[model samples]
Target: MLAESPPETEQSAPPPVARPRHAARAAGLLIALAVLALVAVASIAVGAKPMSLDEVWHGLFHYSGTVNDVVVRDLRVPRTVLGVLVGLGLGLSGAVMQALTRNPLAEPGILGVNAGAAAAVVSAISFFGAATLDEFIWWAFLGAAVVSAAVYALGGSRSATPVRLALAGTAATAALVGYINAVQLMDTKALDKLRFWTVGSLASATMDTVEQVAPFLLLGVVLALTLGRPLNAMAMGDDTARALGAHLTRTRILSMTAITLLCGAATAACGPIAFVGLMVPHLARLVTGPDMRWVLAYSAVLSPVLLLGADVIGRVVTRPSELQVGIVTALIGGPVFIYLVRRKRMAQL
Candidate 1:
C-alpha cells in the first residue's frame, strides 16, 4: 500500500449553511421587477382606446404624435409614477411599523396613521376650504404626527407590547371614524368631496404633487433602510438588543418619525390607500427571511409592483369606468390576508 500520510489534523471547517434566503430574495426581486414592467406595459396598452405595443413603445421613447403618446404621457404616466411613490412609502412605512411593534400585523392602517392623515385632510377641507393639494399637505402631516404621538402615549410604558398598541390604535380608529362619519352626515357637500378622496385615486396626480411628496419619500426610505440594522438587533428582545448596544429609545423615535412622514405624504398625495402597507412587508418577509435589511429592500421593490398592477387591473376591468386602486387592493389583499391567517403564517413576525 502506498505509504499512508500521517492522520491529518482535524481542522474545523465552517458549516455550509443553505443559501436559500439569498437566492429567494434575488428571485423575488426579479419577479417583482418583471411584474412591474408587465403592469406598466399593460397599463399603457389596455385602456378605453387601446393602443398597439408599437405605438406605446414609440410614445414612451420617441414621443411620436400618436394617441398612445398623449395617453401614456399625459394620463397614465403621472398615475403610474404616483403609484410607485405611494407604494414605496407605504411599504417602507409598514415594514418600519412592524419592526417597531414586533407585530407582523402592524401596518399604517392598523396603527392609525392613515386614519390620522385622513382626519386631518377632512378637517382642512371642511374648515379651511383647502381645495388645493399644497394646502392639504401640511394638515395631513400634522395629523399623522399627532396620531402617532397619541398612539405612543396610549400604549407606551417603560415596556409596551404589541397587543397594547393594537388595542389603543383600534380604539382611536373607531373614535376618529365615528367623528368623520358624523361630519359627513352633517355636510353633504363635504361628503361628496370626501367620497372621491376616501376611495383613493391616483387620477389627480400632477408633477407638482410628485415634487411635493418626493423629498418625504426619499427621506423616509433612507431612514427606514438605516434603521434596519438596529431593527434586526432589537428583534432579539429589548434587553438583548440593549446588551448588543442598540439604543432602543432612539431607534423607536427615529422609526416613528420616518413612518409618519412617509405615510402622511403618501396619504396627502393620493388619499389613504390601504393593504399595500399591510400586505407587502409580510410578503417580503416570507420571501427574504426575517432579516429586516432584505425585507426592507424587497418591500421597497415589491410594493410598487403590487400597487401598479392593481392600478392597471382597475383600469382594465371596468373598460371605460375604472375602479379605484384602493378598492382593487382591498379586494385582492383581503383574500390573501385571510389565507395567511388560516395558515397561521401571519403571526410569524
Candidate 2:
C-alpha cells in the first residue's frame, strides 16, 4: 500500500481574506496611522525640553514666537517631518526590494544605496569643502544612483538573479565603506562634520533639508504603491507573473528606480538609519499575512510609527543626554531580528 497522505492541515495554505477581513485590515491601517500621528506629535513634544499638549497645540497654530514656539517651529517640526518622510521611504523601499527579489531578508540598503550616499557625502566634506546639507545632499543622491547602476551591471544586467544582485551589492558596499572610512580618517574636519549624520539621528533636521528630500520621497511612494499587484503576481514566480500579465522586466526596472529614489533621498537627508527598512516590512507582513497590497499599505503607515517611536524613546531614555536614533533601533532590532531568524516560518514570509 502507498504511504498514508500527510494530514491536510499540514499542507494547507492561508485562504484569501473575505470582505470582513479586508475591513479589519483597513481598520488596523487606520489605527496604525493614528499611532504614527501620536508618535510624530511625541517627537515634537517630548524632547530634552518637554512641552505640554497645550503648548504643542499653540506651537502649531499660534504664532507667539516664544522660546517654546521657536523650539517647536525651528527644531521639532523639521525633525518630526523628516523622520516621517525618511521612515516612509525606508519602509516602502524595503518592502519593494523584498518583493522584487522574492527574498525575505532583503532591505533598502541591500543594494548598497546607503553606502553610496555616505561615500559621496564624506567626499564632499573632505575633498570638495561642501559642508552644508544643500551641497552634500545632491552629491549623495548622485553617488547612490551611480553605484546602484554599477551594481546592476555587475549583477548580470538583464539576466540578473536575486543571489547575483545581492552579492554584487554586498561587494559594492564593502568597497564604498572602505573608501568612506579612509576619507573620514584622513580629514578631522570631515569627521567632525559627519559625526552626527553618521550616527543617523534627526538632530540636524532642518526645513531646508526636508524640503529638498520631500519631492523625491513622495514620487517614490507613488511609484512603489503602483507595484503591489505586480509584486504579488511575481511572488508566485516569474512564469506565473508573466502568465498573469505582470511584465516582469518593466516591474523590476520600476522597482529599482523607486528603491533608488526612496533610499537615496532618505540617506542623503538623515544618513543611514539602521533597521527601519529591514524590520518594518517583516512586521507589516506579519500583520497583513503576505498580501503584497496590504503589506505595502501597512508598511507605509507603520514604518514611521516605529521610526518616530524609536526617536522619542531615544530622547527620554537618557534625559539631558540622548542616544542616537540609529543606535536605539539597532539595539532593539538586533534581538528582534534574531528572534525572527530563529523562527523557521519567518524566513519564508
Candidate 3:
C-alpha cells in the first residue's frame, strides 16, 4: 500500500479511439464536399462547349441571354444539377441496399429496379410509341416501384432472408432484361431511341426533368439518413439488430421504400445509369469504416464527385463525341470492383 501510494502520480488519460475516427470522418467528408464542388464546376465549365470559370460564374449569376449564358443556364446548369441528384440517389440506394441484403456487391440493379424501369421504357418506345423521356418517365417509375415491391414481397413473405431477397431480385432482373431485349430487337425505332436511353447520360437533362424528380429524391434522402443507426445494427446481423431493439420488419419496409423512391426517380430521370451505386458506397465504406451513418454521408457527397468527374472526363476525352455517363462509370467501376474483390474486405460486409 505504501509503495502504491508513492507511485500514485497523476497520469493523463489518452483520447478516446472514436475521437480520431470521428475527426478523420469529418475531414474526409469535407474533402469529398470540396471535390464535389470542384467537379460540379468542371461539369459546367468543361462540356462539349468550353466555358471559362468567369463565364460560368456570370452565366449562373448574371445572364443577359448571350450564347455562353444560354449554354450555361439552359444546358449545363440542369445537367450538373441532375448529375448531383442522380449521384446522390444512386449512392444512397447502394449503401442501403448493401446493408439490407448483407451483401457487399448489392447495387440498385440487384433489386431489378433498373431492369424493370428499362423494360417499361423500352415497351413504351416500341409499342406505345412514347417519343420523349418525359412521356415514358411514368412508366419507368411504375415499373421500378412494382418490381421493387414484388422483390420485397417475395423475399419477405416467409422471412426477409438475404438469400431469398437476392435470388428474387436476380430472377426478376433476368426476366425484365429479357423483355427489354425482345422489345428492342423487334423494333428498330425502339432500338435507336433505347440505345441512348439504356446507356444512361445527362445529355438530355433539363430543368423540367430535374424538377420532376427532385421531390422524390428529397423525400427519399431524408428518409434514408434516418435509417443509419438501424442499418449499422443490421450490418452486424438480423439477430443482433433485433436484439439491439431494431424492428426488422419495419426497417426492411422503410429501407425498401427509400430505395424504391430513390432508384425509381433516378432511373426515370437519367435512364438507368449503372455502377455509380455499386462503386460509390464501397468507396465510402473504405473511408468511413463500418459506421453506416458515415458511409451514407460520405457516399452522398463522393458519389457526385465520381459521377460529375466521370461526366467531365467523358466530355473532354471524346471531344465532339462524348461517352455516356453509364459507360464511363462501368469502365471505372469494373476495375475498382475487381480490386475490391481481390482485396477480400468486401467479403466481410
Top candidate, metric TM-score: 1
Q: Give every collision pair in model 2.
A: none
Off by over 4 Å in 2: 1-17, 149-174, 346-349
**Stretch of 10 with least lDDT, candidate 2:** 340-349
lDDT of 1 by residue, 1-349 (tens): 8997655554444344646656767787888888878776675566656777777777778896676788877777777788888889999998988888777667777678888998999888887788877777788889888997788678774355666777777788788778777777877778877876776778777777888888888888888889989999988888999999999999988998899889989999988787788799888876777889989998998888888888878878897888888889889877865665466444635
> Which clashing pairs does model 1 show?
none
Residue lDDT tens for model 3, 107-184: 777667787877887877788778875667678778877887788688784356655766788899888878887878
What is the lDDT for 215 in model 2? 93
lDDT of 2 by residue, 118-156 (tens): 888888888888977778768877887788778778878
Which portions of model 3 miss their true places by more than 4 Å? 1-15, 129-137, 149-175, 189-192, 342-345
Candidate lDDT scores, in order, read 0.81, 0.83, 0.82
The number of the candidate with the highest lDDT is 2
Give lDDT: candidate 1, residue 266.
Answer: 91
Ranking by lDDT: 2, 3, 1
TM-score of each: 0.88, 0.87, 0.86
